[model samples]
Target: MYTHTKKPTGLCIELLESQGGLISLEDFHELWSMLRKTHSLDHLYPLPTDTEEFHLLYIIISRDQEHGDLGIHANGYGIEDEGKYRLAGFACLVVPPNERREKSILSGNPNGICDTADIRIALLPAVQKRGFGRFVVHELLGHAFDTLRIRRVTASVVSPVRPSHSAAQKKQIGFNTKQICRIFETFGFKFEGISRGAVMNTEAPEDDKPVWHDVHRMSMLVTDYFEEHIISSLSTIRSPCHKLPLKTVRLSPWDTMIQRQEEEKRDLKLWAEAPKDTLANDACDEDGENSDVETMLGDDDVDEHDWDMANDFDD
Candidate 1:
C-alpha cells in the first residue's frame, strides 16, 4: 500500500524537505523533543536552539501503508499519529558557507570537485532496529553526490555512554555508539581516526566532575563509491566498465567518405614528419607522454592570488 513517489527508495522512504510544505516547524521540533526524552543526550549532542536552522534539516517519516484503507498513518508501533505522519528519523547535511575551509584538519582541504559535507542522522527508538536507518543514509549520500557534486562526506560521534536527562529518568534508549558506527561503515565510510579529547561532557552527577570525549570521525570518497556500487557490482550489455552509456555515432555515406579522406591526409602528414617505423613513438610523444605536471584549475595564463584573510576557528 506504500504509494510510490519519485523518491520511493526500496524501504518506502519519503524524504520531506524541512523547508517545504510537508510538515511544520513546531511539529518537527515536538517530535525531536520526544526523541530527546527517549535517549536524551543534552550534554553530548544537543538539538539546535534556533528554529531557523531547521531549514537545513530533513524529516524522515514512515507510513502505515497496509492500513491506508482505514485512513490510519501510524508513526511507529505505539506512538500516536494524532493526524500527523509517523516521524521515523531525521538527518542534516551541513555545507559551510565559505566552501573553502575544512570541517577538521582530518577531512583535508577542498579538492575542488567534491566538496566535503558534515553528516548527522537520528532515528526514533520505535523504528531503530529496522533497515530504515541504512536507507536514510543512502538517500542522503546520493543527494550529496548527484545533486551537490560533493566528493567526500563525513560524520563524527562522541564515545557512546548511557545518557540521562533528569535525576528521575536515568535510562538511555537510542542507538549505542557501536551501533551508530556500524551504520556508517555499512555505507562505505572509512574510519578517518579520532580527535582525542575534543569535546567535553559536563552532565556528570557532581557539578565539579566533567567528562571528556574523544570524537571518532569517518569519511567516504566519491570515487570509492562509484567503484564499489556501480563498477564492481553491476553488469551492462553495452560497456563492460559500467560507465554511462556513450551516445550513438551516426554518419552518412558522404560524411564517412570525407572523414576517411581527412584521416588519410593526416596519416600522410604524420609519415612525412617521421619514418613509419618510429611513427608510433612520435605519436606517443605528441600525446604528452613527456609532458610536465598538468592541472585543471584553469588555463595556464590565469594568475594566482594569495588568500588575504586569516584562518578563523569555524566549520
Candidate 2:
C-alpha cells in the first residue's frame, strides 16, 4: 500500500487494493467515460471495449475521510466501507503488449527477468494536482522493482504537436511532454528516445486521413532504482510538492551517462574548493591577530613607515 499526506490539509491518503471487486462494470464505464470525455486519455491507447478483457489491476486511492461519506463516488464504487477510505482515483501497472511473457521467453528470457512493463494513472479532476499521482507512481515503482522484480518500467507521453500542424491535429495531443518527462525523471527514468508516429489519434482526423502523433518514451531500470536510491529518497517525501524540478531532456542512455559524469565532476570541484577556502580563512585570521598584537606593542607605526618606504622605492 502507498501512503502519503495530502497537501494543504495534511490529511492521509492511501492506495489500497480494491477488495471484493468493489469496482463494478458500471463503475469502470463511468470512470472511463469521464476520462475520455475530458480528453485525459487522449495520449493513451483506447482501452479495451470488453471490460473483462481489460486488466483490472487497480489500486484504489483513498483519503482519510470516513467510509460511506457523501463525497465523490466512482459510480457508487468508492463509497463502500473498505477501511473508511474515500476513493480519489486508481492506478495500475500493465505489461506492455510487446513485452509479454511469451515474447520474453522467445527472446531467451524464460524467467522474464529482462522484461519491462508500463504504468497508468487516472485521477479525478479535483485530485489531479494534489500529489496523488506522484504517490501512486512511487508505490508502483516499488512494486515493480521490489515485488514484481521487473527489470524495467516504462512510461510514454504524447509529444506536443507542431504549431504548423492543423488545429485538429494539435487537439489530438493532450499531455504536456515536458511536464510528464520531468515527473518520470524525478523517479530516475531516462529518456529512451521518441517513437515516431507511434499512435494514431482516432479522435481527430483531417481529410479522412489518420492523424498520427509521436510518443516520448522513458524507462527506469532495476539498477537505477538501487543506484539512485529512488525508493529511499521518495519515501521521506510525505507531501510531494507540486513545484517540480527544472526540466531537462536526456534523449538516450549515452546522454544520461554523460550528464551523470558532469554532475560528479561538479561535485568533486566543490569538495576540492571547500578546504582551500577554510585554510585561507584561517591564514587571514592569524594575520589579523598578529597585526593587532603589533599595533598594541607600538610596532604599527614602524610597520606603516616601512610600508610607505616600500611604496616610495616602488615609485
Candidate 3:
C-alpha cells in the first residue's frame, strides 16, 4: 500500500492491491461504463469482453484516502463509500502471453525472475490533472523495481493523429505524443521507436474499413533507475552519455520470430498509403509539426484549479 497527500486541497490518495478484493465486479463494471461515457476508453486497447479476464493480472487500485485516523490496517481492507476512500482508478501490470519467465514468477515459481511487465494506468475524470497520476506512477515504479524486482517496464502511448469524424464529436482522450513522452521521459523511460498501425481506430472507420493508428513505445530498465539515482545525487557532474555494462541477452526462439515479424511489418508499404487525414504524426520526428497534439495537463507548474476533461488511458 502507498499513500500520498495532495497539498492545498488535502486530497489523500492511496494505492491498494486488488488481491484484497476490496472492489466488486459490479462496481468495476460501473466504473468502466463511466469511462466509456466520458470517452476515456478511446485511447486504450479494447478491454476483454469478459470482465473476469482482469482478475489474472497484478492490479493496483487507487482510492480516495484512508477510512479514518486509524487508517487501513496493513492486513485489513476498506470498502468503497460515498463519504471517502472511493474508487479513483487503477493501474495494472500485465505479463505478455509469450513471457514465460515473468509468468512463472507470477505463478510462484521459486527460481523464476520477474524480469518484465507491461504497465497500464487510467484515472477518473474527476481526480485527473491533480498530480495523482505522477504519484501513482512513482510508487508503482518503486514497487516494480524494489519489491517485484522487475528488470524492465514497458509502456505505450497512441501518437497524435487527425481526428476522424466520430472522434471529433467526442472529447479528446489521453495525452498527446509529446505530453506522454515528457511524462515517461521524466521517469527515466527511453523512447523505443514507434509501432506503425499498431492499434485499431475503432471510433472512425472509413467505408467499413478498419483504421489503424501508430503507437509510441517506451521502456525503463532497472539499470536506468539506478543510473537516474546516481545522476541525481551528483548534481554538479555532467555526463554526455552513460552506457550500461551488462551485455544484451539472447532472445528466445519465439521472441526472435516475433521480432522478425515486427520488422517485416515495419518494412511494408501498405500502411504508408493510409489516408492523409487519418495519418498520425511521426513521433520519431523530433521536428515534425504536431498541431494535432493537445495541451499538456497535470504539470505542477500548471494551475491546479484549471480542470480539464482529459484523462489518461494506457495499454
Candidate 4:
C-alpha cells in the first residue's frame, strides 16, 4: 500500500538533516501549521510563541509519494515545491528529551536508556491509503530501534475536527484513522493509555488542567529491531548505528544498581572523612568532575535543578 516517492523501493531513508542547523525555524512553523490543519492537532511543538528557540527541537521530514501524477503537491502541504517535493509524513523529537514534567525518565540516569522519541506524522489528504503510512511508520520505528538506537518511541493519535469515518478505513470518503495505530501495532507497539481525551473519555474531567478532546498514548520498545525493508534503508544511508558493532552487549539491571550504590557510598565516605572546609574546597573539584553533565542534552527547561523540582510535581 506504500506509494513510491521517487525513492527506490529499497533505498534507506535519509535522516533529513537536523532542522536546527540545515533548515530554518520558520520552515518548521510552516510545516507544523500545515500538519495541524489536516490532522486536527491542537498544538505543535516549538509552538508559534516558542518561535524564538526553535533550535531546541529536532525535526524529521518525510515526503509523501504522489500517486496519479507521481508529482508532489505544493502549497497543499509543507513541501516547498509541488512536483519536486510533497510533505508526506514527518516526526518531531522535542528536547531536552525530558521536561521537568517527566522526571522518572531523567532522574540521575543514563539518558540513552531514557531516549524517548515523540513522533507526529501526517500525510497529504490525497495520498492516504496507497500503503505509504505503513511504510513510513515502519521506517520511523526501524530508525528509532536500530539506526538511531533510541530507547523508546511514542506517539499520540490525533482525531479530526469532526466525525470522519468508521474504523478499518475501507472506504475513500475520509482520512485513514487506523493507519497510525495499525502501523505501530504491526511493529509491536504497546498501547500505554490515553491522555486528555484518549478515547470516549474525551468529555471526561481532568485533574487541574483543562479537559482536552482526544489523545491516545502508545509506545514501542526499540531494541532487536526486525523490519527488513526499513533496515535496508538504514544500510543504504549509513546511519550512525551502522557504525556500532553488530553484537549487542546486554547488561544486568541489578548489577548496574549495585555499582551505583558502591559509587555513591564511596562519595559519602569521602565527605565523612573530609573537614567542612575541605568539603567546600572539594565542591570546587567536583564541578570539574561533573562539568560535562551540568545541562540536559536536548531541552532548555530541563536541567538538574528542574529535575529536582520535577520530583515535587504531582504526577
Cα RMSDs, all models: 24.2, 14.1, 26.0, 25.5
Best by TM-score: 2
Q: How does residue 211 of candidate 2 score in lDDT?
A: 72
- In terms of lDDT, the best-performing candidate is 2
Arranged by TM-score with the best first, the candidates are 2, 3, 1, 4
Tens-digit per-residue lDDT, 1-315, candidate 1: 011114433234333335553555556667666666665233234344555333256666665333322121334433343444466557777664433443433366444332677677776665555666665667677778767777887778776333334433333312355456566765667777767767776455334655666677778888766654653233233565667565344443335678999999999988889554755455344665633334434445665653345569657
Instruction: Give the Cα lDDT of each candidate.
Output: 0.56, 0.61, 0.58, 0.46
TM-scores for every predicted model? 0.52, 0.56, 0.55, 0.43
Of the pair 1 and 4, which is ahead by lDDT?
1
Residue-by-residue lDDT tens digits, candidate 3, 1-315 = 222323424234333234455555555666666666655555554454543223233222334444322122222335343444445555655544346665776798845644676667766666667676676677667777877787898887775353453564333332345466667777778777778888887665767788777787889899988787665556445456663344335443335678999888887866776766744665424667553444433335767556755557633
What residue pairs clash in candidate 2, if any at all? none
Candidate 1 overall lDDT versus native = 0.56
Q: Taking the tens digit of each residue's C-alpha lDDT, what string does model 2 give over 224-252?
A: 87866745456455655754454344354
Q: List the residue pairs that clash in candidate 1.
A: 75-86, 114-151
Q: Point out the worst 10-residue segment of candidate 3 by lDDT.
A: 68-77
lDDT of 3 at 153: 82
